[model samples]
Target: MTAPEDLALYVHWPFCVSKCPYCDFNSHVRAEVDQAAWRDALLADLRHEVALLPGRRLRSVFFGGGTPSLMPPATVAAVLDAAVAAWTPAGDLEVTLEANPSSVEAARFADLARVGVNRVSLGMQSLDDDALRFLGRAHDAREGLAALDVAQRVFPRVSFDLIYALPGQAMRAWKAELARALAFGTEHLSLYQLTIEPGTRFATEAAAGRIVIPDGDTAADLFELTRAMTAAAGLPAYETSNHARPGAESRHNLAYWRYRDYAGIGPGAHGRRGRLATTRRRKPENWLTAVSRNGHGIEREDPLDPHTRAVEALLMGLRLTEGIDLDRIARLAGGEAPVDSRAVALLERQGLLARNGAHLRVTDAGALLLDGILGAVVRAQTAVAV
Candidate 1:
């Protein structure tokens, strides 16, 4: 069970140099930004949260963004300093910053490390030049590799992401790329399959019949190949898409998957604190204006019912290799676990789920069918035990 006072912090930087076609995150491009103003606003937002969530221990801090690497290092330092002052930090307090693999940003890694960032997640979407171009990445394969080298040297813990299953990509070619990626000696990896999200350039292209991805069977094969290769290389998948050497998994991400309490700040950030959910204003200008007027950028703080919290906890906790305890979830829901016991038994018989006493998990074969399994297994009502 997760401790109520153990917390994680997610700081969002909403500006980026450029947006990719496949991106739909709350990122924006601007001609110029008021760095001083942004720093103050973020600090103010942090203070607002600190006042409410007092006497808590901070387990980790994650700098995520529209490209957090673009922020002035001083801003990053200020935020970290404020966070350290606000909460009791863990002995092994993990501080991670997500960065794009660009030469310019790579140059700042040392400075970033100096200010409490010990881990870096590089966005090297692909090592293939053609795929990089297709993905609309600003950096070429060589530059991305150069950035990776800098990251490995500057940060004690390093991880880089890659996108596979691109249209027209051959299985043999992906295997070669995957093999090369594992040889990089990084302790962690986040490999994702390419998907066309609505409202993105890729979605527009797909609608026009200009873009095509691999079929379901081929995608499944690719996923299995990825899992097998990574496990062979000693970086097994801990969650659906993330892999890491033993003891190297991302602590910040695990906080989310384990359904622990975290405070989110900055534009478009979301937070979960006990039974309440907080959301910040998404638009940059709106967030700034709100901060100036109300001293915080929060747009909403909604209370969650017991059943809702249990359903959310199950949805998140079930994604991990170490599954949730039904008893614990039942406590959260104020009743039984919000699941269909009949569906659980059926899925277990089909070799897609495993349940022992209160512990339940999706099997390796079931991982591919996770979405369907979730839909079928989650009960519509949680007032009674099934």
Candidate 2:
């Protein structure tokens, strides 16, 4: 039998050049940063994690953040070097860095690649100038494309994000823009619908009637069109918001969806290893202070009960096209099957879920209403188990 997949590493860089109005990620903008001190702190934080979860290979390393592209290549290299030294790296270990499509950040692509970043995910939120302006992005369509060009040339694997269902966006306009984006020939795409998240500028605008997003019917149409177009382009939806060609999926993300162990290092990063869930301090200064005092900037580290792990595993795994392993869910739940058989039967009859041998999956229709389905199923299962 094949050995279990190794742990994954997530290195968070919490600094950004500018904060987007809609972003709620643990990102902050600072006029001045001490690059050396930040680098040392990240390395120190990573070492603390290594000591806790020893004797495992690393399957992937993802550099995510406020804007990881803004990170100096030297900082990235040091972290990668430290990780490899800490654990044996898989032969095809995927190292992905999240970047913004700005000209200055794009200029660092070559240097980043040279230092062992094999994949890059660009935040090219929209291909339209107006959309970029409305979304508060620094790069325009032309500049974004230029950055994408540079990324594609420098990295062996490339993925970019695009936001759809923008305020006042029409179906025809979105379809045309998506087509333009797909023509770039990148193997992976993360397409997200714009939601007025709580505490965001968009939320305030939407609440005040200053911004109007697509209605439910229009948003559904856009979602359907996205699936059809990307499938036609050979990049089918692998997750709710992510599409990729066969064999070109993001491995780092797969680790999360598949419920595998990964270490999250840096401010506001969350991670799971074995049964422990860890969260780091959210602010940069606070994280640095904690790391200096405790050797790791962890804010909380809690041991997850079996039921919680099972629920979380089911929630994450069902988001994938391949679905979850029922056997693994059972193991996580301490030998009790995690799904309510009656609910599964009902949902399967409704064509929202499917059971094929050992796997339980959400059908395409179910994916659109995944949150509701999960809530119902989890409630039913918990009730039955209790």
Candidate 3:
């Protein structure tokens, strides 16, 4: 379990040059932006969270976005400066920024690094030129690789994403691509299967039968292949979709999957602090307005009851290879463990779940069936808050 005083910070940058067809992240495209205004607003929002979450040590700060690389380096620096000043810094304080693998963004890497961004997660969604076009990415394979090379040189730690299980993608094709990706030798990789999310352009195409991803069986095969290959490459699956060498996992993301306290600022960022869940305004204009009036972009701050907190802990912690402690969940729930005893017995009998005293985790064979397992295991809550 994470200490209460250890905190992770997330700052959202909502502007993108263009939206990806498959993305549903809180991102927007606009013709113009007032960089100075945005920088000031973000600082104000950060200060607000800092005020509410005093006596904390900041461990990780993530600049996730529609495209955070688009932010002016000065803005990034200002936010980082204020954040570092607000909280006691952790010994291994990690600062990460997400970037699109484009020449324009790559050129800013050095400046960003100079301003305290030591890690970068590049959006090199595919390594094939044709696949890039199909995914509606602005950068071609050549540009993406060039940007990656620049990132590897500029940032102390680098991780990139790749989308597999594209429509008509063959297992052999994905294997070759995965081989190329692993050979890049980055300490971390986020390999994701292509899914048609609701409201994404891909969803519309699927609805019209104009596109179809791999069947469930084929996708499962691909998932297994990815896990085996990455594990063999020495960057094993630390989480369901993220793989990293030992001691190289993303600290900010790990804070979330481990169900730790984090503060979120800027447009559409969500944070968990103590017993409260916080969310910011999703639209850029609205967020700015909120900041101007209230000094924070928070749209909601809801207190989470014990049962809700335990269920959330289970849902997130089970995503990691190292599972949760039943005792921990019980403490969070302020009662018994939130899981059904009978369900655990049945899943354990089926070899899908494992238990070692108070520790419980989903087995490798059950990883793909995690959704089903979670549905079965988390018991419905009826206890009233005391």
Candidate 3, residues 1-386, lDDT tens digits: the string is 56547899999999999988999999999999999999999999999999999988999999999999999999999999999998988988999999999999999999999999999999999999889999999999999999999999999999999999999999999999999999999999999999899999989999999999999999999999999999999999988899999999999999998899999999999999899999999999999999999999999999998999999999999999988898999999997878888999999999989999999999889898989999999888963233
Estimate the overall C-alpha local distance difference test score of candidate 2: 0.92
Cα RMSD of all models vs. native, in order, equals 1.7, 1.4, 1.7
lDDT per residue as tens, model 1, 1-386: 55537899999999999889999999999999999999999999999999989988999999999999998999999999999999999989999999999999999999999998999999999998999999999999999999999999999999999999999988999999999999999999999999999999999999999999999999999999999999999999889899999999999999998888999999999999888999999999999999999999999999998888888989988888777899989998887888998999999999999999999998889888888988988888734553
**lDDT, candidates in the order shown:** 0.94, 0.92, 0.94
Per-residue alpha-carbon lDDT of model 2 for 1-386, expressed as tens digits? 55645899999999888888888889999999899999999999999999988888899999999999999999999999999998989999999999999899999999999999999999999998998999999999999999999998999999999999998898999999999989999999999999888888888988999999989889989999999999999999999999999999999999999999999999999999899999999999999999999999999999998888988999999999899998998889886656777888899999999999878999988888888888767743445354
Query: In model 2, where do residues sit more than 4 Å from their true spots?
Result: 1-5, 380-386
| lDDT at residue 208 of model 1 (Cα atoms) | 96
TM-score of model 1 relative to the true fold? 0.98
